[model samples]
Target chain A: MSHSVDTWIMALLTLCVFSFLYRDNPFYRFAEHLFVGAAAGYLLAVQYQNVLVPNMIRPLGRGNLLPLVPLALGIMLLGRLAEKTSSASRWALAFYVGIYSGIAVPAYMQAQIFAQLADATKPWQPGWGAINSALILIGFLTVLAYFFFSAPHRGLHGASARVGIWFLMVAFGASFGYTVMARVSLLIARVQFLLRDWLGVLPGA
Target chain B: MDEALDVRWFDPNRINLLVGLSLFILFLFVNLRRARRAPSGLYIRTLPALQALDEAIGRATEMGRPVLYLPGLGDMSEVGTLAAVTISSRVARRVADMGCGLLVPCYDPVVAVLIDSATREAYTQAGRLDSYRSGTVQYVAAAQFAYVAAVTGLMLRERPAANVYMGSWYAESLFLAETGNETGAIQIAGCDQVTQLPFFVCSCDYTLLGEELYAASAYLGREPVQLATITAQDWAKILAAIVVVAAVVATFFGYTDIDKLLKTS
Candidate 1:
């Protein structure tokens, strides 16, 4: 009876969410509000358990001064809660933004810029790969040219940017196809859940 | 075996680093030199999606509905989030100017605070401080799907006429855009995440592709340094293309020298 009740609840919630397809209704609002409240509550609980207890409460209780640093920053961050103390939050925001920017610059340069350049540069390997390799090189160069907004995209530059658009369109198209498949898979999963878990009309677990 | 991966003060074997660093320094130098000169000559090619910002806002004004801005789920650590913040400031300015409602729902409290200040400042600067509502910029939820659900619910309840999504988005990208679409709102979306680009393209009336997000932010900010960086990055990209061409040529002829120079971990 308990299992059947749980199944009914699950089915009802699912239907509440799916009703969004028709139009936004009271049921959807309930589901959405429930989700937001639950998420916020969960995050608070997790932070208290994983972060506060482990890092702050326990360490500070044991007379360690280190946890005070993050605690101070956290308090400053919460200053945004009040309009008067809001300016104090900038100190923490700046600290975060500066550290992140400093780290991200070199990281992006190495990971995104340099690594991509290396892959694009190595066009020739062996066998029938030559054609694909050339296409990649051309596509890459053209795309790079397209992004150069400082230059006047006239004559040769215009032509390359145009080609770049075609390459980009093809890439976006392929991505869309992949994402559609992913979407369909999500649909399939939900259908399976409905059939097996909710209705018990499918095979046993 | 791991000797090749030894940490060094500076590894001479990694020529890619040298080249990248050189290019970066050179870009800085060029931008510095250019900054000393007239700003009038600095030109960026037109991006249609960026231009649609005003149009979308106008649509909302006409419909007597609010403009909803989703700064995505990215925290401040990501440049994408900063870019989104920059864009939000610009949108807030426009909305303030128009005396129209603008709602920014944030997944991060820190960002929510930052966004609130930006929006408030924009209103103040526009001499419309009275119109600035603190509740307009709100912290919704930290969790991904939760944020999505809350934003989608807001879209439904308010029936915002223009929905703007910017920054780093994930699976929630399509759901947000599609919800806005269903609401008959004119949606404009931009993200650095390539995977989410296609979804935005499908559901959004205008979508900024890749670094256009950065470029748009810079364009909107109108900060000389940011503008300089964008142009400098362009020069670096051009130089990168040249290097790629040379490297490919050398590789075609079975020369390992160029290959060695370009190899990175």
Candidate 2:
């Protein structure tokens, strides 16, 4: 088997993370802190290179004034560091939230609402497919009815919402199952690494 | 003038979308205006999970321990952040009145500031401004695992009696809840994440499902604008159901025009 500094470090970090299953300890804390510090440092460098230098500094350097609007907002955001000046952050927050809400309105309406409705309205094909289409329609309506709290869920609304709960449970069950499978897959990969790459207990290479 | 440089304000292919958007907005405005003039006594079915929030807070107050709210680990710009802070404000108000300690460990510095201000404002509004502590709303850690580690440690050491988890969560949902459970805390969690729902459902004493999280906020706030918007959303859903049923019938008899009408570029 071959060995390298990178490989050893990888094994050590992996083991450190895995050790949390048993109990939290100094080694785990060291790895966790190191990970956070590394991430923060990387984020700082990326922000400078990708955002600050390029978007803000260069545009101003090229004699464009529009970037100043965002630069000013960024500066105002930093005002949050001090209590006396923190109120200035509200202007930035308001602008950010207002813009986001405006953009999200049309975007959400188009994609989530209209597009979904359009798809739901697809022509029902015949045979067993027709039955499936009907079920989908029922499921969609019931689930939607479940979310519709403007009308009290009683009588028909109550019945439909109950049905919706069943559908939602099924959906959640499937999602939960999928997530479990994903975690299991990760466990398998880690175990395979420990055996094959680290210990060379299996055939390969 | 290059034809290639020509920019159209409205794309012809999405005329259907333009019409749909217009109608929806018009409907929302009409409902909003009507609601403003006279609240329709908006019927929101009782959610046990939301009710549990008060009970959980009360339990912490009774136990003489802090109530911890972990608003998931997302960027400050997301809708979840807004929801978190909104709920945090509500909780802070209640905490001030009850004289119970509140813990809000923020992931983003910007959000830390927002929530701190929000909590302070809530405390002031409750006329208990002196009780507000800035340390409760400070940033914990930025990295996901680091945040989880720090929170887990907090749960072990602080041993909050009631833990409220909300907003958009990831893999760390269970991590926090399991740790909170070890402390024998009464936990209530809410989120729109489908995958994390199961974990919350299993671990949390009461869990608010998807869409219900937003509904809970609107319910708690009961602000006119939010109520009207929620009413519009319900109407939209009803309209969608109608459309779905009609389209299914139309298609069963062989209709293609509806499909074409919805197509976009």
Best by lDDT: 1
**Residue by residue across A1-205, what tens digits does model 2's lDDT show?**
4376676687788898778677667777777777767767777788899999989899999999999999899889888779799889889988877887677666656666677777777877668898987888889989998888787889998899999999988887888788879889988988887777876787783
RMSD of 2: 2.9
Please write out the lDDT profile of model 2 over residues B1-265, one tens digit for every residue: 7468647787888887788777778777987787788775655668788787888888888989999987777655456667877888888888898999999987777677778878889999999998887698988767777788778767866889999988889988878888788789999888877788888887889988878887777787777777777787787777777777878778767775676677676
True lDDT of residue B201, candidate 1: 90
The CA lDDT of each predicted structure is 0.85, 0.81
Interface RMSD for each candidate model?
1.6, 2.4
Q: Residue A130 lDDT in model 1?
A: 83
Per-model TM-score (chain A alone):
0.91, 0.93
Instruction: Mark the regions of model 2 whose C-alpha exceeds 4 Å error after superposition.
Output: A1-3, A203-205, B1-7, B38-40
lDDT (tens digit, per residue) of candidate 1 on A15-51: 8899988988999998989889999999999989997
Indicate the docking level reached by candidate 1: medium
Candidate 2, chain B, TM-score (2 decimals): 0.89
